[model samples]
Target chain A: MSGKYKDVAYYPGCALEGTGHAYNRSTKEVGKALGLKITELKNWNCCGAMEVKNVDPKLQTYLSARNLSIAEEMGYKTVMAPCNGCYHNLKKAEYDLAHDQNSREVTDRLSRKAGHKTYEAGKVETIHALDWIKEEIGEEGLKARVKNSLNGLKIANYYGCMYTRPRHIFPEKDQGPGSESTSKPHFMDDLLAAAGAENVDYPLKTACCGGAHTLSDSDTSTKLVLNLLTTAEACGADVIATECPTCHTGLEMHQARAEKVFGRKTKVKILYFTQLLGMALGLSARKVGVQENFSDSMDLLRERGLY
Target chain B: MPIHEKSLIRPENLVTHEHLEIEGVDVSGHWSTFINTRAVSDYNEQMQEEIAALPGGEYIHRCWQCGSCTNACTVNAINPDFNPRYWIYLIRMGYESELLRDKDIIWQCVSCNKCTYACPRDVFPEGVMKATAHWLELKGHTEKKPSMVFDETFSEQVFATGKIEDGRVLREFFARTKQSLFQDWLIAMVRSLLMRLPVTLMMKLGLATVFHPRTRGWSKAQAAIDEYVHEREAAARKALRLDVQGAE
Candidate 1:
C-alpha cells in the first residue's frame, strides 16, 4: 500500500458476517482502491454485543473479552468493526481492561464460568472504522483521488449511537486536529466532503434511528424513526447516510411509518456511506449493493449516471 | 404588510427546506449543495478502503435505518429527538457537521440501558454516543454553556487537589455562572456558619484531619496521574485510528 496505511486486519463482526455483509463486500472493494490490504481475522466470533449484558451482566464482558482474546492470540494488535454494536462491545472490553480493575475481575470470573482465559490488562486496541480514514489516509490524499464526486447530494449524516456518546466510556479521542478523532463524527463526512457530496448536519444526527427497538416495541421504534426522519427531512437533506446496518434498515425501510406517523412526507434517499462512496468512486449501482436498500436509492444513482 | 403575524412553517413545508449545521453553526436551505460538494466521490475508493478496514464498519454497509435504538431509549421519551440509531448511521456516512451539532442530544442519555437491552443484534448504540460525547468533552467544553461555565475551574481544582470539595466547586460554579455577589454571599454565610464551621474547626483543631495527611508532592502526583491518563488516551487513539485505517 503506497498510502499511509500499509496493511490492515479486518474483523467483520457477526452482524456484518450474516446480515450486514454488504458493508464487508463494499469495504473490501473500496479498501483495495485506497492501497490498503484487508486481511480478515480467522475464527472471529460474535462480539457478545450489548444484549448479553442485560440477559447476564456477569457473562457480558467475558464474552466480549473472548473476542478480544481471539485477536490477541492471532497476534493482531488492531481490529476494525462495521457494526455499532460490535464497536461498542469491543470498545467496552478495551475500556474495562484499561481503567476498571473490577471489570477485569468480573470478566475473569466469566472466563472461568465459560472456561475461557482471562483477557490481560490492555490486551488489544479496538476501534470504529471512521477514525482510520482520518488518521491514515489523511484528508488531502483521500480527497485528491476522488473520481465521480457526489457533489450536490443533500445528505443527512446518521451516527446511530455507539460511535460517539457517553464520553467517559468512549475508547478514542474525537475530532482532533484535522482528524475527526471521535466516533461517528463523519467517518463518512470526511469521505463525503472528499467525494464532493453536500453533507448537511441535521439536529437529529445523534437521534436514534431505532436500530434494535423494532423488535420489542415496533410502534415506539417507528415513532422515533419518524421523528428523526422528519427532522432530517426538515433540515433539507435529500439523502440520509449512515454507518450502522440496523440504523440503515430502520431509517430507510421504515420511511412509510415515518411518513404516516409524523404526517410528513419526504423522498430522501437513504444509503450506506459505502454505497455513497461507491457512487463517488464511480461504482455501478449493482456493484455497490444499491438494490439491497429498501429506499429507491437507484433513482439517485441513475440520476447521477452512477447506475 | 398588514400587522405582521409570524407564520410558523407547517409540516408541509419541511420537505421544501431543510436545516443544516456545520461545526455547530446551523443553516437551512433547499436541499442543494451550497458549497462545491464535488469532492465527495473523488476519493470514495480510498476512504471506502479506510472505512472498510475498521472491524465493525462492515455492518455500516448493512445499515438499513431500522429505528430500533430510538424506540429502545427511555431518554427519547423526554426529548423526542435523541436518536443513537441515526447518529451512528451518519458517522458511517461521513457527516462531520451533523456530528458536531449533535453535542446537545449526546448529553440527554441517562444510560438506563434500555436501548442496549432492546437491541436485537446487540448493537450497543450507547457506546458511540459516549465516544462522541467524550470527543465533545475535550474541545466541546468551550462550546457548551454548562461545561464552559465551571468545568475548567473544577478540573483545575481537582487536578491541583485530588478531590473536589463541594464548597470550592460550588463557589467556582457560582462565580462562573455570574450569580449576584449578595446572593452567593448570603448562601455561603448561612452554609458556612450553620453547616461548615463545626467541621472546619474540628479539622483546624486537629480532631478531624487525623488521617488527612497533607498531600505532599501533589504536583508530582498530579503529573503522574495526568501522564497515565494521557498515555491511556493516546493508546486508545492509536488503536482507534489503526482500526479505522485498517478496516478500509
Candidate 2:
C-alpha cells in the first residue's frame, strides 16, 4: 500500500452481499494483490438503490447520506463503492446536499430523527472502484505488477448507465485530458489494457443493459442485452468486461433468458473487470469466485490457459 | 432513424387508394396516400402540473421540445413507441387522451438516464418518465405495472428495515405480482450457480434467507421515512385531484 489511495473505506452496499458476491470477492482479491487496504464502512445501510428513488427521491438521498455520515464518523476522508448504483446514489446525494435546499432540509430532519450525526456535503468524497484503481495504481504500475498477463484475452469494456449519466451528479468526471468521459468512459479500458488484454472497438460501451426492469420487462431487457451480447461478439470480443454488479448480472441473466424464452442464444461470456484483473495478477479463477457467477466463464478461461 | 421524426404518423392515420383518379391525376397505389386530419380535444389542462407535483418531475416546465431525450432514450431504441419526447410533448400540451393511447408501455423507461444526459434544457427526462409512469397508475389510466409493484415491494422492505435482503425482495415481488418463484430460466441459473458454489458459501447464502440482514438501530430512521412517504403520497394524491379515498 504505497499510493495515494493505499487505504480507503469500502461500502459494498447490499447487492455485493448477494447477487454480486463474485464482484465483492474479486474486488478484494485484486486489492490484496495490489497491496491496498480497504476498510468497510461501519454498519452502513442501503443506499436506496434504483427502487427507493422511484418511491421518493429525497428518501433515497437521505439513505445514501446516512452511509456517508457513517463514513465521516469513522474518520475517513474517502469512501469507495464498487457497485455503480451505490456509487451513483452517493454522488447524487452529495450533489443534492450541496445544491438543493429541499434535499438538505429532508436529510437534516431524517438524520436528527435517526439520532445519527448529520452528514454535511464535502465531509467525505465518494469514489468508484474504477477511480480508486485508476488513481491509486496507475496503468504503468499495473503493467509492472502483472505476473500472468491477460494475453490473447479480447475484452469489450462495458461501463453501463449509472457509472456516467445525468452528468450533473458526477462533477469530478469530464475534466479535460485524463479524466473519465461521460459519453466514452475509458477507466476500465485503460486498466484492462495495462493488464495486457486486447480491448475491442466497442461502440456501445456506455449502452444500457436495462438492469432497472430486468424482471418487470423481461422481453425488453432480453432484446437490449441481446444487442449488447451480439454486438460484443460482432466486435470479436470473447468476454465483456463489466464494472457494475447490476450490469454484469443483468447481462448474464438475460443471456440465459434470451435462450430460454426468446430462443436467441449468444455465447459471449460476462466477467467483472476486477475478476479479470485478479486473474492477470496470477489469482486463480476459483480464487476470484468466477464459479459463483451466473455466467460460467471457466471453460473459456481454461481454454485460454488463464487459470 | 431514432423514431422521433416520424413516430407521430400512425398506420391508422394513413389513407391509401387502391385505384383512384383525382381530376385525371391517376393518384393510385403508393402515390395515393393521405394522412387523416387529426383534431385533438379533451385536453386535461392540469396534466403537466399533476406530474410536476411528483418527486422527480419538478423540472418538466424546462423542456423545449429539442427531441434530444427521444434520440438518446434506451427503450426508444428497442421499441419506437416508447418515445419520451412525444410523451413530454403530449403532457405539456395537455393531450391526455392521446397520451392514454400508449399508456401500457410507458412504464418501461428502464431509468437509464441517457435522455437526461442528452437533454440540453436540463429537463431530467428520466425523472419525467418515472413521473409519467407514476401518474398513469395514480390517475387510473392503466393498471399498476410490474415495475411499480416491484418498486413498492422493494420500498416497503427498505422502510421496514434500513437494509433489504435480495431474497426477500424477490420473493415478495413475485408473490405480489402473481408470478411463480420457480421459473425455468431462474431455476437453471440458480442450479448452475449452486453447482460451482462451495459448501460453506452455500450454507452462508441459505442462512442469509433465514436471518434476514438488517441495520442496527434503524427504527428511528424507519419512522422518519414512513412519515415522509405518507406526506408525499398525500401531496401527490392532492395534485392528481384524487380524494382521501383515492377517488377522482
Candidate 3:
C-alpha cells in the first residue's frame, strides 16, 4: 500500500453532525482502528449538499471551494470526505476550478469577499473515505488487521447516485484495475469483503434513492428505495451497506415509509460501510454508534454472531 | 399508415370510429383509428434561449435526441411522463404549449444525473430538467414546488449560517410546507432511534436544535454569497424578461 493517506484533513459536512451522526462516528472509529489520522478542518463551512446546487450551482462551487481552502491552509495536500455529497462537491469544485473559467472567477470573487485565500485547483486533492482506506490499507492489509471477521455476513454495497454520476468530476476513477470504476464501484464491496463479508452480486449498486427530493417527494423516494431494498433481498443480501449518509438515512426512512404508506415491508437492514468495518475490527456496536442509526440492526448483528 | 409509438400520441389527438365506412371501404373499429392533425403556432421562440440562460440549460443545444437520457432516467422509469428526452426536444423545438403539459412533474427529475452519465452528446439532461422546472416557476406557469421550498429552506439556513441543523431544517420545512410534523413513518423512525439512543447523545442532539451549528466568522462569506445570489437572481429575471413586466 502507498500509505499516502495515513494523515489527511477531514470534512464531515452538516449531515454528519446531524442526521448522519452514526456514519460520522463509525468513520472515525474505523480510522482509529486502522491507525490512520484524520484532522477535522478547523471552522469548516457547509459543502452545500444537494439543496444549494438548486439555488445556484456556482454558489455550491463557492461553498466547496471554501472548505478546500481550509484544507489547504491546514497544510494538508489530501482532504478526505466520508459523505458522498461532500466528496462529490469537493471534487466537482476542483474540476470546475481547473476547467471552467467562469467557475474560477466566481470562486475567486467569493473568496476575496469572504476574506480567505482563494482555493486554486491542484492545491489539495480530495479523496473519499473509501479511497482513504482502500489506497492506504488494501484488502490484504485489512485482512491481516481483522480482529473479529465479518464471517460471511451477506452485504449489498450500495454506492448511490452522487458517488459516481455525471462522471466528469472524479478524474482519478476508471483508470484501469487498481483505480475505482464509476460504472461498477467495488471499493466498498472490496473493503467489506476484506472484512469477511460475502459481497452479493447486487445490480442496483448505482441506483438513485431519490435522495435529492426524499422528503419533498416522499412517494418517489419510497418507491426508489423499495426497489433497492427488494433487489438487495432478491440477491440474498442480509444487509445493505451504504457509504453515503443520505443514502443510508434514505434507505432507512423510506423503508419505514414504504411499509407505512405503500404497505410494502422490506427487512434488509441498512448500515454504513464504516460501521461494518469498525465492527469487524472488534469495536463494539455502541463504539461505532450503532445505537444512533435509524434502523435497528442489533438483532441482525447478534444473529450473525458479529457482536 | 398508423403513427409510430401510438402510446405517445395524446388521447385527444387519437380519433377512432366504431362503425364507419371511408371511401367505400369498410374501415371500421380497429381499422378506423386516425390521428388528428393540428398546427402548433404558439411556439415561444424565446423559450429555448430563456431556459438556456439558466445554469443547467446551457448545454441544451448539444442534445441530438439520442433518447439515452430518457432510457437512463430514474424518474422516467417510475413515471413514464417524466421524459427528459422529449422535454429537451420540445424545448429545442420551442413547443411551449406541448411543454406546459408536464410542468408539474418536471421538478420531480430528482437530479439523478444518470442521464448525464449515459449521454454521449454531453446534454446534461438532469440540468436541463432543473432549468426547465425553474423556467416554469419563473414564467408563472406553476407555483413553487415543495422541492423548491425545501431547497430554499435548506439553502437559506446555509446562506445565513454556514451550517444547518437537521432538526431545524425538518421542522421549518414541515411548517413552511404545511405538512404535519407528526408523520407516521417519521415518528416511528424517531421512536426506534430514541429507544436505542443513549441519553447523552440524545441530549446532545436536542441541544443542537436549540443552538444551531454555525461556522465561526462566517458572516463575511455569507454576505458575499448573498450578494452573488441576488445578482444572479436579477440576471435570471432579466434573461426571462420578468423585470420588464415587474414580476417577482
Best-fitting candidate, measured by DockQ? 3
Name model 2 segments beyond 4 Å from true. B1-37, B245-248
- Please, what are the lDDT tens digits per residue for candidate 2 over residues A12-68? 989999889999999999999999899999888999889999989999999999999
lDDT of prediction 2: 0.90
Measured against the true two-chain complex, the DockQ scores of the candidates, in the order shown, are 0.01, 0.74, 0.81
**Model 1 lDDT per residue over B1-248, tens place:** 12221123534324433777778865667654353222332221232223333322223344445767788676668566677777666565555544555566574454445555555664555544444454454333324444323434544443454333334444666677665445432343344333322343334434312332122334543454345334434544453443323321
Candidates 1 and 2 compared by lDDT, better number: 2
lDDT of 1 at B27: 64
Per-model i-RMS: 21.3, 0.8, 0.8
Candidate 1 segments exceeding 4 Å error:
A1-5, A112-117, A174-176, A179-184, A259-265, B1-248
Structure candidate 3, residue pairs in collision:
none
What TM-score, to 2 decimal places, does chain A of model 3 have?
A: 0.99
How displaced is residue B226 in candidate 3, in Å? 1.2
Tens digit per residue, CA lDDT, model 3, A1-307: 8979999999999999999999999999999999999999999988889989888899999999999999999999999999999999999999999999999999999999999999999999999999999999999999999999999999999999989987999898999989999999999999999999999999999999999988899999999999999999999999999999999999999999999999999999999999999999999989998888998999999888776
Weakest lDDT window of 10 consecutive positions for candidate 2 chain B: B1-10
TM match of model 2 to true structure: 0.94
Q: Roughly what TM-score does model 1 have, to 2 decimal places?
A: 0.55
User: Where in model 3 is the C-alpha error above 4 Å?
Assistant: B1-9, B14-35, B244-248
